[model samples]
Target: MSETATAEAAYYEHTLTHRPLDPVSRYTPHPGLAQITSKLLTLPAEIRARIYHHAFQGNRVAVTSVRGCYCGSVATGPYRDDLNWMLKLPRWGELSYEVRRAFIGEALWEIHCEKAFEAFVARFRYLSNGNDALLRQVRHIKVNVFEIIRESWLVETNVFGPALRSITFGPWQKGWTIDVPNAVESPDELSDEKLMVRVTHAINTKHGYGFLKEAWEKGRVQRGGWKALFLFPIRYHVKQKDGKKRWQMQTWRADLDEGVIEKDWKDVHLVQEATLD
Candidate 1:
């Protein structure tokens, strides 16, 4: 090596011991090493994901978990010598879910199960699309479900009452690669009748026939918060399943209200995505 260049390199390496750490390493990074670190968040997510993908060759498992009791599953009829009854996901759980949904509709949410963890959920996690924003926010991980829809147009339909398309689940850390169905030109190509059957089946499977009927009656997330068993706000529409229902997205207006109000009800659990190879 050239003397001037070698001396300069030696001096730079010597000074490195005295220099303090870079400031961009806090909220995003764990310090100490000269090697690659978390502060790499400064780079674009796509780029970082590519780096991770290349380095790991996609072998790393993305895991998450959520804790909450399935409301209907809890014991009710029996009791100890004292004759105590049991209830779960009461006012506190209901109110907490509603408040979170009302204020941050897009944010990922989970109902904390108070029941025994053995039979009920403790957490949920899924593969991330390299969306660091959600990974940073989600505190828990792990999942499963009642219904699985294969409709193309359903992707564009509102999750609650035909108000929005592309429902959001977890900004899961190491997110599951979900295959969200594509929007088709004609929903008629898909069977509306069959979809209804699945809906009925999913409801029955998750909640009993009796609870299903009650949810059908209440029919609104805000009002039906009480009806939510494992989840919140069971809703049912009496009108015939409109196969031709015009699609709509969630919106808010303040024509008279002092603050922004929810124009459409949203369900966090009911909406989901799948991983297709």
Candidate 2:
């Protein structure tokens, strides 16, 4: 089998082992909560799923370090009251598995720094007691680029699990900068897209590539574990368009193939555009 196929097969196998409970089994209520739980479960599977999505949809969670301790909090989107009530329901343990699966699967987890990333992983391992079931449910993440660059061990670590479908590198604060090898322009002066292009190139430079290659060769990273690598940085700012100021964020997806970073702007996408206050 091709490497991509092999990696995909591994992921498929992993998913099967941690598949979420079906609606019928999931709705089986705990002792005291039978009335409400049974009523909800009696609904069609599709309806139950819709309810789960509505409660957790668009949830953006941020993981950051404060006073040297790592913590997570809701960064955006409403924290639905229904979801809160569900958590406090009788024998929540009986329903927590499916609820957590939906919540983590749908939320976008954002990690702010390298240390916070480490803390997040460590906390997950500690809380889950090394089981990757919860990690596998995490489908989306928005993290600092430095986390990936410094923690290249993630390339081989099972910490992220096989279900991670999207990894966005940044929404770096304006004016943040990084040193790029062989770059003539100052990072501060470059536009966000251009700066990200340089940063991507840095990842492919001899030193950067060498570290990744060393890790793979040393068996620290699984061979063909990753299918493809792309970094999407979210940039927020104000721009003058049509003689009016507007809030906008530009994003670019750069693919890394065979240790080379492909800098293509054709994939640039504008997100969260709105009027600036």
Candidate 3:
């Protein structure tokens, strides 16, 4: 993508959306370093700034963890991955549509699971031609992945609903990708398992869902003396399923090392790692 276009779109999304830019490196870099140290030195400030700018340029939305839960399956439950389909949209318009449809299907799936303890979810279905007749019976859904630190995949979509063809849902097949400045968390800190749980609660509850949802509805980010960036509300569903329904928020399998390394909601234990290919 053109840097100019990226910057413009990013400016709109950041400034207009009041999305927070990732923090600058708190640790100052040495002005000059020996040849060997060069490899370890941070990128120049101007360059780093540009990199930060570009990282969140297009189709990049913030993610956070599930609220009020510890254990959820990482792969199937609530989690998120960067939308990698944006790059392909402008080139193959039809392909973009399909990707977006798939996205909606995934999102719808999450909505179903969030609203009820569903035993099964319909397959995220889409057609090569964006056919409404053929898609009449297909279901689409989405689950959000909330990013707290540098990491993502905390909240995820795991359910589906019937597909639609209007613009409201036309983009259903278009794909998505997230462009985060960096992985907020990394290297799995196992030494402080207890502390990690506390931290998780703080992020998932205090800053994750509550804030973003308001932001989306308000269409602007509110600033405050105590508030920081990347705070917003999360989407939740409270619908009927299998002729039975009750409110139960989805959970995630959080791993300190892998960052949602895996999830298993029924047990309510966010393990340290996930077992996925």
Best by lDDT: 2
Q: What's the best-to-worst order under lDDT? A: 2, 3, 1
- Report backbone clashes per prediction: 29, 0, 65
lDDT of every predicted structure (CA atoms) = 0.26, 0.47, 0.28
Clashing pairs in 2: none
Q: What is the TM-score ranking, best to worst?
A: 2, 1, 3
- TM-scores for every predicted model: 0.22, 0.48, 0.19
Using TM-score as the measure, the top candidate is: 2
Query: lDDT for model 1, on a 0 to 1 scale?
Result: 0.26
Name the better of 1 and 2 by lDDT: 2
Error of 2 at 165 (Å): 1.2
Please, what are the lDDT tens digits per residue for candidate 2 over residues 84-150?
Answer: 4455555445455566677778776656555666766766666578876677777776554332343
Candidate 1 regions with alpha-carbon error over 4 angstroms: 1-105, 115-189, 205-213, 221-277
Off by over 4 Å in 3: 1-188, 191-199, 202-208, 211-277
